[model samples]
Target chain A: MRLATFRGRDDESHVRRVGLVLGQGDHVRVHPFDAGFDLVELLAESAEWRDSQADVAAAGDGLALDEILLLPPVYPVAMRDFLTFEAHVDGMERGHGSPGVPDAWYDAPVFLFMAPHAVTGPYDDVAMPPDTERLDFELEVAAIVVRDVSDVTPQEARSAIGGYCVMNDWSARDVQGKEMSLKLGPSKGKDFATTIGPWVVTPDELEDCRDADGFLDLKMSVKVNGVEVGTDRSGNMGWSFEQLVSHASRASWVKAGEVLASGTCSTGSLAESWGRNGSLTPPPLQVGDVVEMTIERLGTIRNTVGPREESVAPVAPARRRSRLEASA
Target chain B: MRLATFRGRDDESHVRRVGLVLGQGDHVRVHPFDAGFDLVELLAESAEWRDSQADVAAAGDGLALDEILLLPPVYPVAMRDFLTFEAHVDGMERGHGSPGVPDAWYDAPVFLFMAPHAVTGPYDDVAMPPDTERLDFELEVAAIVVRDVSDVTPQEARSAIGGYCVMNDWSARDVQGKEMSLKLGPSKGKDFATTIGPWVVTPDELEDCRDADGFLDLKMSVKVNGVEVGTDRSGNMGWSFEQLVSHASRASWVKAGEVLASGTCSTGSLAESWGRNGSLTPPPLQVGDVVEMTIERLGTIRNTVGPREESVAPVAPARRRSRLEASA
Candidate 1:
């Protein structure tokens, strides 16, 4: 089952409704649930509830997919993205003139908390952040948590994922590098906007794509302005999704409606591509450029780069002073 | 005005209600609003609404403070903690064997997104993360946003704050150091729990404490098991709260009920004190130790360190592979 959140295209009230995607391509339709149904709430219920919803969806004739505007399937309660692709880390490190991936990278699956409010819709226009000149997009996939779990093993963690979706972890390379130099975050650098959806494809729909080790053998690709820039197999990830989720829950709760994203895959962004190839063939994104990313079975999300708005300048640095002078 | 969220001491329903704190010390009382009143929603309203609520509060008989259990003043929509204290940063770098603060530290107010779900009540027990041996508490103050604002100047951003509260950003030093070695986050290290509030003190209530430049001249201190270990002036911060808020909203929205923390003040944490003194005099926190942090005018929050829960081991690293081999 592919689930989505959408509002009727011509509806002035702008109320969001959950739906089950039916058919495909131009003939696709959406079986709308009750006006008050929420995907996040539904995902938190028992498996029997989901099956009941699927039964209800099968009975409806539904509305044409083109009649509605798709929003992100779930407005996550919490968001974390992990760098599980070793090739992407290698390229990023080399790009910064470092030797290669840090030995610490192999110690455990590491992740950073992201601003859940930064999420935007599948077909939305991503505003170019005022501070960046090197705007980029990351092609990835994300798993939506089905229920709350903590201190769980990899096997237990796997059961916590309800579905998956294509994700674009937008980036501002210039801003990110400067901020990360302090060893804290890529906070504002990646928090301006993140695109997810077209729809969430439930795990049951991808059973055939899972390998013996539980890695997804799905093709992932990204195209900018009709040009294919990168492609990689999801199975290339250094750590499996279950392992990443398990690591994330080691000391903290992975709550229902939270999103755990697979950080940029190999060649998933222009920065990595430039590092690997040693040339910026296709330069950083400019306003009006279109970015479209897709993961097999999950779906595609396409967004256009919008204009950067005028922003206030950051405060000037305070004059240096001794501890005694500061305390005085 | 002082605002808080609380529930009746014996109320098994556990319904949270917003209230205004009246009186002080042993004579303190809380004027509870209607059952449906939410502090987050109230903050998002106009000043007139706040004044009207205060009027209603003034007319109530109220409940004894000891008869209610206090919760965090607000369950933040988002949380960001900024390292704005130069003294703390200097001590931290020196402790890590670096000469002093990094040059990039002066560029702008650097912050990391924290897990909002980790927040607990002022007097709650903080769970020691399973993966760490060094548990610490950071003494800080946080401003809760009153309204949604974007691309605002420092002056404009200042008005977006509704009130301030004491914050304890709990940390796991061993885990944090290892994660920062990879330069992405202090994620799991600090996400287990954060404690905030006794109650939120409105800015108007602290006007007399403000210096000419708008920096708060408040005294902050921390104690462990009745032994005073750290003290610092809040005005020693290199970046003011307004500046931090402005920088945070450069290209993103700072919404109402979100929290912006003033990081750690000088000598706020055992780790910083150890860094400055070249000795772990008080040592890392033990499971039964009590931590009490106080900010002038804002109030105090006390938490006890609880035992760590057992967690699953992280997955072992996969065998090294070339990009071509992995992709194929």
Candidate 2:
């Protein structure tokens, strides 16, 4: 079952829905739920929830998956992403024509929280901040937690995983690389925005396929403005999702909606491989450049890059006073 | 206004009256909202909420602050604490007998969300995890976000703050320091459990003292088994709460109800300074250790560490068919 969050046209409110692709593959059915409702709560009450999802997939009669917008599957309580891939690290260094990788890069995985508000529908225009000239995309898989887990073993970790989703761990490479060297991480860089999903596929649907090597499957690609910059298998990770989950779950508790993304895969995206200081000089996504990312068995998400409009809506003086007094 | 979450004995819940200490002494009064309802939501809604709190305080007839049990005030979306005090960091290093701080230590303030499930009420019998050999306390102040903020300037940052509270960012020091070098952060070590209480004081009650020093001039002390370990001031910080909020709000959206803690103060508590391993070894809180933490102008919270006991209740087995289906 592929689940997604969409913004309704008239109301412009967020809704969670399950996508049912029709037999003709031309359309899909969207079953929406109330705001604040989550599948985790439903699953917690009874296993029937999973059975219903399967039943719906079997009875599919609906719209094309591409017609709808996609928001990140997990409304994460906490979003912790780690940079554990050495290949991507080396590729980044080599791409910059640098001397070598930083010595500390190999010791531990560098991680950071993707800013929570950067969430957008899969089809929403990816806003390119004026300060960030270089924007890149990385096709990766994200792990979703189904239940509260603490100090989980590798095997326990695998069972705790709710499902997988295709994630475009969007990047401002110039901002990331420069600030990361300070040893803090991409606090302001990759955190600015991260994109995920056209859909999230449940684990049972991909039975026996979540192996370490299978996870690193090399069949993913990133295309920017019709140019392919990164292509790699999923198995390229130094650590599997299970290991990452196991390591992350030690002592600390992880709630149902957390997202743990695999760092960029080797040559996974072109913008990161070619971006320069505050410049998206190569493979840059312009106002009309449609960025398309796809993973095998999971589908493709297409997003357009455009100038950021002043969405800081105008505030009338009276309304401002009222708001101030109300919150004051 | 001092707000509290308490489970009254009559099987009745009250979000009504909470205790507050004023110039004359302690008094109890009804907050303008029902008990058990999230206090953070109320704080975020009205600045006048604090004004109403003052009204409640003024009308207080003869109540006392020490007579009630206290629970963590705000419901946190995410709790990110920073080790920003140079002295506290140095003391931690000294406790570990380490030569110098790791490179990542200078990294951005490392933070982790302590499990919300671990929260206990003030005056409530605190329980220790059987496996933990060390339990420690940290004396600090926490800032609550009153409004939604993103990419805010420092000046705007100060306005985003809703209120403040006393927090004991408890730690299993050994576990934390061991894993921190691995670059993950004080995940297991510092956040296994966290205790915060006895009440929250809104910003209206806290006069602006930033002109004197970037600190909260709260006099605080900690005691174990009625023995004084250390004392410190809240204003002694490497970065002020305003700075932390500003840095955190940059490109990072902080929602109402979110909490940011100013790690521990220098010599503020035994766990942060003088204790072995920065924590009392055999860190178990015995049945009689009366732990008291006080913040000048705020109040003091007294909690007694108690022995663990079994309290498991019987559960009816699920219907047979349901069990069979689950097994299947």
Candidate 3:
């Protein structure tokens, strides 16, 4: 079943509602929750609500899908984006002048947490921060947690996922490369924007998409303006999403509504693009550039890039350091 | 004045209320935010709600401070923990085997986004993830953003802060070291728990604590299992909270209710203690161990460490790599 969060286009107030998208002849219909529903707020009660999905869908105010403005399926309480594709990791390692993939990559699945507030809809205009010389896009698949899970095995963790969606993890190359050198997580570099949405597809709806290995074999691609910039198979992830979920909850409780993303696909980002061929580095995004991403099973999410109203110097002007500090 | 979020001791329901903390000789009086007050919900409207503060304080269901359960003031939209103090940075760089504090540390502040979902009450039990051999706590001061701000100057950013609180940034040294070695982040290591509270003290109440240099001079200390482990003056921070805030919003939108933390104070964390004397590395916190933090004007936040019910291997067992993957 496909679930969606949306607001009536006619209502500028933007009151959000959870809806069941019923596919009809040519137009799609949305069945909103009886009184009200908040996707993020309802994640904790997912199992219960899921049990009565039929009843809830049977009764609700319905409208044409085009009559509503869609919002990201869920505003996750927290987000973990893992670098699961060995090819991508290898490319990144070599790009940084490192000899080879670290021994630990195979020993454990690694991930970084993203800002929950950076989530935007399928078509929101992403504000290009002034400091970034290269604004790039990442295409990946995301799984949203439905139940509170902790210290669970991969098998048990598999059940905690409620649904899937396409994710565009936006990146600011210049700022990211500089700060990451300090050996901390990417905060400002990737915090400006992350796009997800159009709709969420439940696991049950993708029964046919699952491979024998229990991974989704979805085709993922990214298009900038009208040109195709990157494409890859989502199923190429070396580590399964189940392993990612379990490792994520290893020591911490992954609360309802948290999102876990399969790291960007091999060749799914522009950084990998630059590493592949020095002469082929696509210049960063320009204002009004349209970026669209589509995952075979998880629908499409497209966004337009916009410029920040004002630009602050990404890094303040350098200042004199203490004699000892400079020498060190 | 000082604002607090609390729940009645008799109510198992964790519903939170915003209250004004009025100090009396022997006890504290809490003016409950009447039946209509929602501190967490109204955080986005911080500036507006702050306007009618006088009226809200005048009329409310009042209770003794001890009669209610104090919770973390607010679960922010996002959290930015900055590595600010030159002392702490230099110590950490040396401890990590790096030659010196990176040149960029002086150029601008660098920070990582923390899990907003990890927030717990001031007195909550912090479950020590079973995997950590070194359970540690970081003592620091935090300022909560009350208004949406973007690309603002330090002067303008000052108005965005709603209040201040004592923060305990719990860490698992083992996991953090491995992750940071990958040069990505300290996600799983630090995402497990972060305690904040006692209550929020608004800027208006902190006027006397301000120094001529525009930084707070509050004394901060941490005690483990009733033994003093770390102590430092928050005023010793080289980067002011306002500078942290302005740098935070340099390229992205810092939404209302976001939290900006002054990185761990010099000698205010166990990492520093471990470095100073390897033998003095107090045994990693054990189950039932108590950890407490006190900031002069903000108040104290104490938490007991609890054991995780189950333990998953912190790092999953290693698996074979492909020929191409192994050699990269």
**How far is A265's C-alpha from truth in model 3 (Å)?**
1.0
Tens digit of lDDT per residue, candidate 1, span A209-231? 98767887799999999899999
lDDT of 1 by residue, B171-287 (tens): 999888898877787877898899999999888888899876788779999999988888998888777788888888887878887899999988899888778778875699999
Which one is best on DockQ? 1
Q: Estimate each model's TM-score.
A: 0.93, 0.72, 0.86
- DockQ per model, Cα: 0.57, 0.11, 0.39
Docking band of candidate 3: acceptable
- Quote fnat for model 3: 0.51
Please report, as a residue range, the 10-residue window in candidate 1 chain B with the lowest summed lDDT. B318-327
In the range B100-159, model 3's lDDT, one tens digit per residue, is 678767767778878777889998898877557888888889988878887888888887
Best to worst by lDDT, what's the order? 1, 3, 2
Please identify which of the two predictions, 1 or 2, would achieve the higher lDDT against the true structure: 1
Backbone clashes under 3 angstroms, per model: 0, 21, 0
lDDT of 3 by residue, A216-327 (tens): 7788888888788888776677667777877877767777888899888877888876765653378788889999898886777889988766766554532323532565
